[model samples]
Target: MRSSVILLLVGISLAFAGKHSLKYFYTSVSGDKTFTATGLVDDVQFMYFGINTKKASPKTEWVREIEESDYWKRQTHLLVEQHHWILNTIWTESAGEHTYQITYGCEWNDETGKTNAFRQYGYDGEDFLFLDLKRDEWISPVKQGFRTQERCNNETIRLVHWKNYLKMDCIETLKKLLTLGKSSLEKTVSPQVSLLQKNACSPVLCHVTHFYPSDITVTWMRNGQELKNVKVGKLLPNEDGTFQKTVTLQTEADEWRKNEFSCVVKHQSKTFRKTLTEKEIRTKNKTAAPFDVTVVVVLVAVILSLSLIIGVIGYFVYQRKLKPALSGSASKCWLSFCRISGYVTANTSPSDSENTSQSSTES
Candidate 1:
């Protein structure tokens, strides 16, 4: 499954940055059967291995275009090794009762050259051990993790292997992934901006949807002055591989009518300003159908009335058509029916009726 971990934005100030990360989640439990891992390019999931699946698979179309079958083989083999290692490490008398989790990953910012590689262990959802990238050593935040930290620190070979993996191999993998998923992950898409409201009395909402590169700025302004305390929603992904966000202004509708209020959004190199006005807002609320008995009864009555009117009109329309093969007597009967309905007049010459009867008899 694709990892739900949001991109770890460290010390970011709306700067242009691109980060790629590979996260490995290993659980020593019955759930998921064993292990899972996810790789994201610019916070967009490109490849992942799940619990219910047999092997790692690409999540995006571009990643599926990868021709190197060895890539998948290597990833799957590494995950299997990691699965066995974590199981052997944590498999004890307490293993059956308590679930142990191991999360190790390497994250690198390609633009700013920031690296945040980590390896963390959790016992029953509590922090046990973590790698100190700066100190180049393992640190135990809790007393129970001391033994593990000391043991891992003593294993100098394994430490070097893991550290090098994080520093060199991991970063190389990220670079390769970025290149493979460039067209999908790096493509810039402009956001769709709109002003929305639940109803006339609801707060004004600035909805920005379907954008790329999650580093975006959405702000509310009133009379050209920036407004504060607006409720900003988290950036979410759309089914079409784009992002969406919303900023809510918790104010009455009258504020917009009295003053000039607007929502300004900055994405990539483009800027959009949506002015707040009654016409700009989609005031019609998308709500569920009413459960009131009176409304149901009225709707049913209106439907029945329309059905009856259509049936009546259809019968009269059908009766107004006269068959050409009708004899004189049959024609007379048809004319009588039409005259009763006031659709046809009784204007026919005697010769006309006789010729009609002769033509009908010959046919």
Candidate 2:
């Protein structure tokens, strides 16, 4: 009777064990680039994953980052042979436009409910076959870590994981985020060159204006070298929603000959760009030169003329004193010296003949 009881107990245990059904669900995606799903099962564990890209060769099988609890949990239950777990599944989109495909597949041990965690699976020339399910089916958006019915939508399904049950709606959210990033990529500041001055001035000043949404940085580069001693000015925003910065560079009179300056605009992840120098800064300088020259010439002439007049008056007073010191013969000598020296050159011209003096004697 004890033997019969043992047989009956074993049969019952086997039947109950066979009845236990373990269902593992996940999603796979494909398109531009291919990646597999992470966090395959909460109580269950990640087994393995396969990565394949069109442009590149397929990657060797690798395991995802699994938690200690997941590892320990799988250990508690004895593992069986050839158990495949859902691995990395992600969607890749094409360039220029938005399109993606998801690829994922898994094989679980039917005999043992627990998975074989130690072994790695390699791609044997056959691509993974995944059941593409509706993305909305698996998307249960959780607020505060709890899934809700309101967040679920039916149309959110992705075609990549139609075979298996992995929530694919998250791909839509990822795609949306990527699209947003791409749209703003063009909006980033691109270096532009423009001429601010049509005519050159003494110190040619170049104004660089950047049309960007955020605060901008401006640097002056002269022939690919960073400029120093440049009179840098403030950056101000225009009424029409753009930024304007002014930099004044005093080119040595020689610099105007080459006549070039560059304003480089720098922003995040942006590169070399320049604004052409203005013709006005150089042209304006030309107009200023004639005016400056004329002023200097007039100032010098006035100074020289004033000095000549003063010298003539001083000489006349000195001679009057000399006449008293030498009254008689010396007076005649002094007069002869003055005439020979041409002291009266202003009153007489070389082309005119001189008139002789009449002698009057006091007897």
Each candidate's clash count: 0, 42
- In candidate 2, stretches whose alpha carbon ends up further than 4 angstroms from where it belongs are 1-201, 258-260, 267-363
Residue-wise C-alpha lDDT for candidate 1, range 1-83, written one tens digit per residue: 11211122231332334655766666666333455677666668776776567587777877775556687878777777766
Candidates in order: C-alpha RMSD to true structure:
16.6, 29.4
On a 0 to 100 scale, what is the lDDT of residue 174 in model 2?
Answer: 22
Best by TM-score: 1
lDDT of candidate 2 over 134-188, digit per residue (tens):
2323332233212222332233443233422223223222222222222231243
Show model 1 residue runs off by greater than 4 Å.
1-34, 64-68, 91-116, 121-129, 137-159, 199-204, 221-228, 254-261, 283-363
lDDT of 1: 0.73
